[model samples]
Target: MKDRVTTPLGAVTLLLLLVAVGLGLSSPLDVNQGSLVRLMFVHVPTAWVSYLAYGGTGLFGLLYLMTRKRRWDRLAMASGELGVLFTVATIVGGMLWAKPTWGTYWVWDARLTTTALSLVVYGGYLLIRAMIDDPERRARVSAVVGIVGTLYIPINYMAVEWWRGVHQTQTLKLLGKVRFDAAPVYGWVLLAATIAFTLLYLYLLRVRGILAARDEAREERELMNDLQGDVSGLTPHIAGQGAQRGGAQHG
Candidate 1:
């Protein structure tokens, strides 16, 4: 694992994380949230990674369906797993931040509700994969599910705007009119954190993809070995029966 962490990509990801942490620590506190604003450094970036991971899952799932390749399926599965993990992280971080801000641990806000739905959707996707035994069928069915589940992303993003719930509207907008509510330094720190988290997601995705491929390959090998063993065990019994039949016929 030292070797893995020492690779160029991993090294860069680690470096970025360190820089983000340093910037976040040094950044001025929010006037409204005070030091609690630091939580945004973690919460926003994790939320971003969750979105990225699910998007990757859908993209790779589409590729798998189109090409019928195990590699694509593996990548889709890896992305789904990471997406679920990061979604959970996002929720937990949000809850931690919300408890103090909202005086409640949970709420039925549109954004929060939609985010929860997204978690369920991808969680179900992983569960479906576990239930299926046939690799080909599993890949096909899960690919469709992965692709469809991505529909939640847009809805989740727009939930605050559409429903006008307690959840705040988008703070950082990429397209059209650029909007950032926080101070410039805060935005800079957030940008750094986002870059770090994105890199971390990519690094984790690559690791997870490799592990998934190895796991599938290992399972296939074990299945083939079991079949070969069964055949070998039956061969002597069949031969013995054949000899007995020959003897009876001679008698």
Candidate 2:
């Protein structure tokens, strides 16, 4: 199948650009936060996409184990790595916003702690893969980590409610509801940014999967060459044995 970026990602890129332009012009000049709140368009959507990428990794990891297909494994691996990158982006961006709004760059708040722990977990996952030379073992360990690491996502989301924390209550949520100080145009802008970042995430995953597949195919070809060489060496000895058998039969 043709990759999504070669086709659908074009639509996403175009649409997101138009929405971003609209958001910039429509945002009201807030009395308290001023124009800085416009950063919400990018920040909130990036946070959502980070969760999406990791969720995809976990789902595909399960599918890979069930079907025993290397393609699914590749998808999972690519998503997991990309998820880590995006998760880091979300934390950094949150800190940037928090410094101005909350008056501090760092916090021991539940939400922040959970996200930091998530980073450490994934970091260890990556480090373990690097330490191991064998391919099969690496996949096995990563699959386990991807599967179990899912618990942290919810913790990150509910950290404010679940504990007395520095993080604010979720603004965009089902129960508590959201109250945005921006125009309806800004809402569309947020929707556009979410879709755009998500497309970018998958695009990166597909690119990484392509490189990994090439590396795997190259290794397989090398193994085939070694096997053929061994077979070539044994062929001469086998023919000599056949000749001796023929001589015994003639006698």
Candidate 3:
């Protein structure tokens, strides 16, 4: 753990997080939402990371299907795990932000609903892996599910615009045309926050992938050990049966 944190990538991630926190703290209050606007610093970045992580899950899953490699499956699993985590964080942060803004901690608005649905979908992806014993079959099924689950990401992102729900439309739009509604300072702080969160996600993904690989290795070793133990126990029984048959023949 200490070795991981001391690595170059980890050091960079830590530095960026510190910078984002400083910028978010010093950022001016929103003209409307006041202090509540600060929540955007954490909320928006977490949402972005969730989207990124889920997207990676789908992409890596596809690669696994094409290549049939354990590494790809491991990466896909890691991405899915991180996706679920960030999705939960995003929901919690949003709920905190919403209480003051909308007077409620929960809502069935399109964006919120879709976001919740995506969380469930990925959660199921992890569940599927746990239920299946065969690694190859598990990888195949999980890859397909991961690919299908990613469709929710676009739907969730566009839900506010498509349904015109209580949730606000995209504050920063880059497709077709680039537009930022808030002050320039907000954008800068948000950019910093986004970068920091992305780095954090990458760091977590690498660590998780390594752990998954180790787990697979350990499980494989245990399985081999069990098979060898069964064979060794059967060998003595077979030998005794053969000796008894020989003795009966002699008598």
**Cα lDDT listed for each candidate:** 0.90, 0.76, 0.92
Clashing pairs in 3: none
Candidate 2, run of 10 with poorest lDDT:
174-183
- What TM-score should be assigned to candidate 3? 0.94
* Per-residue lDDT of candidate 3, residues 1-251 (tens digit): 45545378888999999999999998888889888888988999999999999999999999999999999999999999999999999999999999988999999999999999997899999999999999999999999999998898888888888899889888777566879867787998999999999999999998998888889899999999999999999999999999999999999
What is candidate 2's CA lDDT for residue 94? 86
Task: Find the candidate with the highest lDDT and give its number.
Answer: 3
TM-score for each candidate, following the candidate numbering: 0.93, 0.81, 0.94
Superior by TM-score: candidate 2 or candidate 3: 3
Model 1 spans > 4 angstroms off: 1-6
Number of backbone collisions per candidate, in order?
0, 0, 0
Stretches off by above 4 angstroms in model 3 are 1-6
Q: At residue 60, give the lDDT of candidate 1.
A: 95
The alpha-carbon RMSD values of the candidates against the true structure, listed in the order shown, are 2.2, 3.6, 2.1
On residues 122-193, what C-alpha lDDT tens digit does candidate 1 reach at each position?
A: 999999999999999999999999999888888887787889977777778665787996677788899999
Q: Can you rank all candidates by TM-score, best first?
A: 3, 1, 2
